[model samples]
Target chain A: MKDVSEMYIPTYDDVLEAHERIAPYIHRTPVLTSSYFNELTGAELFFKCENFQKAGAFKVRGASNAVFGLSEEDAAKGVCTHSSGNHALSLSYAAGRRGIPCNVVMPRTAPEAKKAAVRGYGGIITECEPSTTSREEVFAEVQAKTGGDFVHPYNDPRVIAGQGTCSREFMEQTGGVDMMVAPIGGGGMISGTCLTLSNIAPEVQIIASEPEQADDAYRSFKAGHIIADDAPETIADGLKVPLKERTWHFVSNYVSDILTASEQEIIDAMKLTWQRMKIVMEPSCAVPLATILKNKEKFAGKRVGVIVTGGNVDLDKLPWMLN
Target chain B: MKDVSEMYIPTYDDVLEAHERIAPYIHRTPVLTSSYFNELTGAELFFKCENFQKAGAFKVRGASNAVFGLSEEDAAKGVCTHSSGNHALSLSYAAGRRGIPCNVVMPRTAPEAKKAAVRGYGGIITECEPSTTSREEVFAEVQAKTGGDFVHPYNDPRVIAGQGTCSREFMEQTGGVDMMVAPIGGGGMISGTCLTLSNIAPEVQIIASEPEQADDAYRSFKAGHIIADDAPETIADGLKVPLKERTWHFVSNYVSDILTASEQEIIDAMKLTWQRMKIVMEPSCAVPLATILKNKEKFAGKRVGVIVTGGNVDLDKLPWMLN
Candidate 1:
């Protein structure tokens, strides 16, 4: 296991290195444009579609970088993480590609489909109660038993640097956008956007979109410090996690603003994207669009880039269907 | 209106002209690949995503060609068609783009979503009973009243030439595939694929996919003649129509084979695509994937191009949601 006593921040050079290292493992997912959305919001929207990424999320970029960056000695130990969603699947996918063992500590309450997907990638799952206390305890025990190197979902410098590659591609693909909007969960994607855009295209505004139900990142951005949320509920299950120190560093320094969207708004935007754009994306991915639609005046007539984070959702139980 | 006394079969030259003409309007949609599907069927699958095309279907290619090809006088008089599906929305979209009137004769029982989309695109709808006799009768009257050019959904050479552009782009994008698979609706898309591929890449085999319930094209292919069905039923609403003379020319000559899938198989493939590919496609679009999965041995180790026909579906009532 690697030492984690001191906080180490990843730089632009690390992001550039991560891009080259993970290029073979990750997909340069297509950038899509919707004329309907463009007309509705009066803004030229370029969708960075990471929903179609390997393992069906952008987290694969980070997970692949982390797994591949491991030294020969550390690689023998494999990797471990606690995620009920895309990160768990991504880490499993990356580890499986390297032909290494991946241990996942998922909440027992996680969807059977998600559990099946992790297993589909040959991930070994250890279930825990749906609480931070239980998850931490279960994850520690699994890590100790498996002797696996820990790969934190978002806060890790390697993961953040890896996630930064998406924006580098976004900037190259779209030429340039006035603003880059992405859903902020643990702030992995947003922080990565900040880390990349702030260095390369500092003129471009980095906006963090959050679910109003779990707007800790938004609060943290306002409060000028990390604000933790306990079991905040929203249809966007991925955005419930609170931001940590590494993510907060980039968020505080580089993010222009943190906007939020309501649960109903997120659901509506998600359905709209599916209906018009013809892409299957998760509710969490809709937060950016929802906020953009709500604040049309700010984005109107500007070339905006929106990150469609992932497409890992339970099809049978789509959020809109429940209502 | 232009004369239609003789049936003008569209050639490769016409396809080239159509591509040039419609290049400005329609999207040169990206071709997506799925490793999961490739591993499952042992065939390399290249999906030409027309679901993301302008007006949410490949029909826009043909519709735009017909609408734009008209002489100043004919274009002023506008175009008309009888369709309850993608063709209606597509023609409406084309006419709207050209700043001309689009007359659509649709069954009054058609989904309200379809009616609204047609209206949203500035299409004037003339409702008739949900029967061929009623549709034809109403369509003829509407044409006589409006003095509009009758744009037959598939039979017209202009429409076929426009759809042919899709395969032209597909061939260019994929660097030529061993097989081209598409749903046999009224045979517009299939005929187009046959037209473009037969000339540019004659070595490529053309495969037509059909719903078992509406297997008129399959039966017609086997019987070596056109077999029109009076009224067939299937969940693939886009493929319920019988092939006309022009489409039959390509289907009988160029098409290597016609494959059929059961209702359950079609639905399963549609859901599987949504789940794994993370793309929103119509039930009709799923037909090719369904057929490919069923006949894996025939396509094994081959690079296959599958046309995702459209994305115009009622989201409130997805096929998998019905159960």
Candidate 2:
């Protein structure tokens, strides 16, 4: 991601305020530890369970922050975004908390379960063709008619600051960790981790984990520039997006490394977590542990804080159950 | 459960000692709440997530207490049990924690996942024909050969005392609840709850939940005597066991009601829990919530503590996925 603005980079104070602003609406999700994972990776893992976050992901923090951070005049129009995943439902949840309308522009081909989730949270969905251009075009019309605030899932400073609170709370909860690892898609969570850790605990290493199939972030980190993919497929559906300007600034400056894991490793680790840790987490959230296990020499004997990103899995459509 | 002996009924002091004994071996799992389920059932539910406990079940408390409570001379002989479920693995885990030899007699028809779990925790397994007489015959031979002490899954005084600690912790964590609910198999957990609550929080209602297909505990509660079923079938395999002497004592004395849920209702509630609470739990754990949902008028507008029993589930064989 490139720097979206020359002067509006979110500072530590913004993150502090975002924490205070969204405290009422968001959950201070618990941090869980697994001795089984710790022994497997040779790392003392403190899993920040964002899967237990409201709306079933950490995206709620950013969505709530963006919704609650709005000015009285802008807030009246409501909030709108284009997402087919947790972001859509999170934005709707935040809007519901604020008693404001939420408009979601999603592909018509999106799963009915996801569509129902969006509507379940009081979101008004306007379907678009399953293409980026069509989504943006449809979103523009919806935003124009509703005069709703556009809360980008990532890239936006408020969203970044809101996500930063996760790492902030993690740091305070665990006292401190030697390193922080989070899965990367659009780089929102990793960027937030970098932003918060760099300001408060600069010595803590920030490592971003991504699937080898969707290794755009790994490529971008190595190339010293942004590399956007049209549509890379992986079991880790949450990490299909590319890094944008605002997120890239943090990735380039603060991220220690961007590691990629094989598809098999992610699935194996995800299954192990569900069995051993007794927690339900998505495949994307399993990437960090997957990468950590693959490179045990790098993480061994260290206190590693791994972000469990979400738990919104289609139970009937489990990857292992698929042909 | 009838008193196993004329004078050896476990007292509250025994529960306190068990709590202290197992504290080092087991996890004090977090108490979780789902506002979603609360709204759906019109009851404030606080889930004591024993599913997240060591060995993925609350049985570890009793197993650990028994393991650690043994005299050094008696400990040298080791411990033994006959179980095909969480108790088998949990006893193995507890024995491993205490560096003692553990032997298990399991039906050959038990899931391979469970057998592997027992082995993972250092349990030596002896397979038996899948019947009560066969299991006892095989277990007796194994115990005689090994000179290992028999640790009944739920009937032993130490095991009941250890399970009582859960309610003790729940009372401390949530301050207190109007009613307490847990699934009944041989009545171990329910007996433990009855033991603790009757002594300390006698005002609290103790409700036992069971699968209607294997409603031995339900029948016993109404009949005022233990009802032993030769063979009953249910997806909640853990609840198929008949109430034993020790567990029957507590169930008969303190339980207000023994509610049963149909097989379909249990499956639905289990799926709802996995989806809404974002946690992985076995079918047996879902019985409490299923009964709660069925008896909404009885639980409505009241604070209820529901014990989430275990998460040792075969992910590939989820009930909904089965034909």
Candidate 3:
């Protein structure tokens, strides 16, 4: 495999390779539909349910691809990443599948449940300050000490290629759709979606949904360049990160539009889904549906594919129950 | 079709007919598995997800069968039932599918979410007191006034036959299981499981799970006769009803044992499932898992089929949130 650090953009071919390589480690999650939402929006919505994926998120696809795609020499050093959320859990899961050591650098402030999950997957954790700079500095030291290959959460070509497999599966499962909507955080899921759909179903529009509280990606799309957010807050904790260079390539080139949803809209959509669709999805995953609901005229009567990115929410602290 | 009010016991042939009748109206829900639970309990568990079924519960299977099997004359008059739960929503959904009126006699104290769902499906609600005596009295009056076909939630032969279809699908989906566990209330799902498994796979042991607070079924199983509780209470609201004569016929004869879980145990299991399996299921549905976790020795290393009965929970009132 080419060096993931080289800034090499992944193609459809790389996605095909990722799909084949990660087949044994990840699940091809089910596609679900909701009649209530369909009637309310006048759009036929098909939800690609990655929440039910292994490790309770779609990041497993990228993590599995990164871990298993490693050459024997690289694999021996094991894999390491810096994440306090699903990526941390997912990378650990992937490493466990291969029976290799996985090191994670997490902020000390991360939720205990998430830390426990990382440890549950046999990941060795090195705690860092909650700041991005501190996390990066700590993660570098861990990688230097262990010689573990770095797996950037979304910026790596391998991860993007792996994420593309989801849209491939979505297209195959649903035949086709007029538009595809996904929530953008660091833009790994959206970039992967862009790569796959642009190569195969270029006619389909790709819409990136973002939380208005953390609208850096939205601002970047309009500004036509990569924009960085030092710190932003939202109920959609997963979507607080800024877009990087690799993701911005696809977002600027292939994504048809970027949409934003308010914090209340995200929470409302999340609760409504749990009540009506009877599925547990995170607030970040609800951004797509929230945007669609807010801009119904754009999606009404169209076949829309919604990527429900993950289902890793703290059960005791649901957003609706917090009031 | 045989008269539902005649206390007729349905057979495998009736189950087959019911399956065919409801095929067009109901969803053949997917069976889900969790490696975490498998490792914890040492049992190979297959969760038959009726929580994802049409109208968000397995009750839809019975409701669909009753609504579709009625003769043109009977169907024209519509159908009625008294339930403050999934059955009310299910019958309403089934009737809506058939373009027929459905009258639900629900307790006024039923959560507004459930009431709204019933109305959303075109069910006309006739409110009554929370007590069963008042429910029955009001239901009788409504039936007399509308001349609607009375569809008992669990006791009717047609309903049992319909519910039996779930096990048929479960067996087909999982090949077969060593033990099948389902939560017991009026024992509709358990009775149906008994009818199906006993006819086709009698070797598979049927276990009924009940809440400790609403332990009438557990007590009745030990006493070798029906035991009615005047007003039992539990977080598993769907399981407060005692076994009716029609349901007891199968429960007593076919079920190998009855299990019960305390309210706290049920809540813990429910929260664990949402966190780990990432599925939105109601407290009533958690009884099987609660009992399985409680009695690990009974199910260790065996292929166990779990019925996740429903997912129509109030988002604002999660049991764990009540301090």
Please provide, for model 1 over A51-152, each residue's C-alpha lDDT reduced to its tens digit, 9 standing for 90 to 100. Answer: 999999999999999999999898999999998588999999999999999999998877677788999999999999876678889998999899998999
TM-score of each: 0.97, 0.97, 0.97
Clashing pairs in 1: none
Using DockQ, give the best candidate's number: 3
DockQ of 1: 0.84
Best by TM-score: 1
The total of clashing pairs for model 1 equals 0
What lDDT score is found at residue B135 in candidate 2?
81
Clashes of each: 0, 8, 0
* Candidate 1, superposed: residue stretches over 4 Å from native: A1-4, B1-3
Poorly placed runs, candidate 2 (over 4 Å): A1-7, A108-111, A129-131, B1-7
DockQ of the two-chain complex in candidate 3? 0.86
**Ranking, lDDT, top scorer first:** 3, 1, 2
Worst 10 residues of 2 chain B by lDDT: B1-10
Off by over 4 Å in 3: A128-131
Error of 3 at A171 (Å): 2.0
- Model 2 lDDT tens row, A87-167: 888999999998999999987866566678889999999998765677779999999999888988887888899999999
Q: Candidate 2 or 3, higher DockQ?
A: 3
The number of residue pairs in model 3 that clash at the backbone is: 0
DockQ of each: 0.84, 0.84, 0.86
